[model samples]
Target: MVMCKDVVENIIGYIDAELDDKTLEELEKHLDECPECQVFVRTYRKMLELTGKLRERTFVTPEIRERLKQLLKSKLKPN
Candidate 1:
């Protein structure tokens, strides 16, 4: 059975349609049963979509910058 961490690790490939048939099958099975992973994958895809559409000269408010910084820090923190 695929774990949540496995889902997280492979999500980018899954979204890009780069995963192989066997791995993609496993991921689909996991996603079907895992609501948390489903949410995570959805959010990751949305982030990819937003970033791909981002303007080169976009403005970031100070508060938004700070929040993004915190989010990055938390994600990078060791569990």
Candidate 2:
């Protein structure tokens, strides 16, 4: 069974549609029943949309993109 923690951990992949079939199915099942998780997903997507709008108005150079990628990679690494 997919748990709340699993939802959080796989959120990015889920939003990006990168999860495997089984995991994706499990996550969807959980989301269907979990109101809190449904809110979280909506909020997360809204945040992404707001940030994306801001990004659209700003100039993000290749250097900035690479730096952001490196920063995200570092932050996403398991301790």
> What TM-score against the true fold does each predicted structure earn?
0.65, 0.69
- Please give, for residues 1-79, the per-residue lDDT of candidate 2 as tens digits: 7888899999999999999999999999999999999999999999999988885575888999999999999999999
Candidate 1, 1-79: lDDT as tens digits: 7999998888778878999999999989989999999899889888887898866656998999999999999999999
Question: Candidate 1: misplaced stretches above 4 Å?
Answer: 56-79
Error of 2 at 40 (Å): 0.5
- Against the reference, the lDDT scores of all candidates come to 0.89, 0.93
TM-score of 2: 0.69
Residue 59 displacement in candidate 1 (angstroms): 7.1
Regions more than 4 Å wrong, model 2: 57-79
